[model samples]
Target: MTIMQEITTDSDQRQPIITLQGITRSFGPVQALRGISLALKPGRALALVGESGCGKTSCARIIARMDRPSTGDLYFRGRQFTSSQSSEDEKTYRRAVQMVFQDPFAALNPVFTVAHHLARPMLLHGHAKTRSEVAARVAALLASVDLEGQSTAGKFPHELSGGQRQRVNIARALAVEPDVLVADEPTSMLDVSIRLGILELLSEIKRQRNLALLYITHDIATAAHVAEEMIVMFAGQMIEWGDTRTIIAEARHPYTRLLLSAVPDPDRPFVPGESVEFLRHAEAIRKVSRDASAAIEQIGPNHFTRSVTL
Candidate 1:
């Protein structure tokens, strides 16, 4: 079965806020994405999981309109907008779809306060017309992200912790009242202890705002925390995808298993002689999983895995 067939959910009956159909991107001789298709519906998140250079960020950039697809159709609420979009329409589209970048510190300006960052978007998007309204909306936005409105508003980015800065980033994205939120490794740069809090905040915000979220991450374990549906990509192609808990419980793809097995376990100590053996095994899996002509198979009600040609 193809990925499209397996990804058919009852939620799809409701028109997706953002849809990527056969999206492919390339730069010169290098192809970053290949026949990628997915839908993002309100109040649901689809996690894109893969190692570095597997085109996860490329997919996010395409969806966020930061980069255009080399070949594909991008649809917003069932209307095709990939090829032609007027200036006003484009601006509207951008406002409706917001992005939370990976680097927390880099996303915020050191010179700006939290209130300034939030208020600017609200004023620019016409969410707030008056100075008082912008200030009130800024306070509300910070509160929505669990930041203390009074204390956080007056502080600059450098004054906050990594996790706190990420919260502000999310609040900035929400200021525009976007229907879709694309978070690219939002927790990767934070301390390990606070990652779960950030993930929980994202899940809560999704439910509260009814926002379609595309969570891009390399960590398979973390995907289960923030996403309902999961897509496992390898070499620019989706190798497996399904319900997060289901796929994690019974992963069919060799590549998926390799990723899950790689998760750190304090109980399992590393052996001195295991490094070379593990590297060889991982290399073998990569070689087979990289085959372009792999056939997809539906392995469960919502689960699908690709057959690696060996």
Candidate 2:
């Protein structure tokens, strides 16, 4: 099948800046995304957490227009179009939404200065005027990402630390003044100590600029750190999702609990005479979660868990 045939539908909504309905992708035999659906509202973030190959990056690429789904409804802003969009339309859609990938180190070229990277996006999207205008805008972008324009704009990506490079990536995404930001494993590549700094920057952007953000990661702990709402994915399907606090406190699905249980505890809990019997049960739960046909059931306000049979 061609690219357009891969993604099923185009159903936009007026309320959401971006929406995905029944999004499912298959690599011939392997289903990458199993009818995944989520909406990104302006000024809020939804954390998509899952193990690698659990469809987080696939979802990111689909939303970024870099990849397409096998069968699903995609919406921009209250409009409906055929899944097979013209090249021009695709370009337009990409300009409205942008992505920050996991490896900030690899996302940029070693030779290009920070100015060159940020300036290109601004010029490509017509966010800047002449070279001088591009310079000014690039500086502003650097500042927005909490980097020093004077020092950063002149430095190459390699000269910057992982945190700084990620900042530059975020700034480059904002260079186009996009409504949606898709961050896939954004902080996983950075030093653990600096991860919070990057998360804080994203939060500040959402609050100040009213940008909708999608934070895709495997780290559930950090999901609560950045996103107000969360969706936990396993085996290419959502297992548990709801308010960040609610999902954390009232986890129902075996996968969700297992994930939470896997979180390294500084003060590890001791089980009373239960020498990991729950672990065998946990492995069984994972095996069951590997199936993609589980139904979804709402357990609380905006909280949902996968209904796995057998």
What TM-score, computed on C-alpha atoms, does each candidate reach?
0.93, 0.90
Model 1 clashing-pair count: 0
Tens-digit per-residue lDDT, 133-198, candidate 1 = 988998899999998999999999999999999999999999999999999999999999999999
Instruction: Provide the overall lDDT of each model, using Cα atoms, as 2-decimal numbers.
Output: 0.87, 0.81
Query: Positional deviation of 236 in candidate 2, in angstroms?
Result: 0.9
Model 1 residue pairs with clashes:
none
Taking the tens digit of each residue's C-alpha lDDT, what string does model 2 give over 36-135? 7777888888899988879899989888988878888888885653286788877788888999999998999999999999988888778888988888
Which runs in model 2 stand beyond 4 Å of their true positions? 1-14, 268-275
Clash totals, every prediction:
0, 2
| lDDT for 77 (candidate 2) | 81
Root-mean-square deviation (CA) per prediction: 3.0, 5.0
Among these predictions, the greatest TM-score belongs to: 1
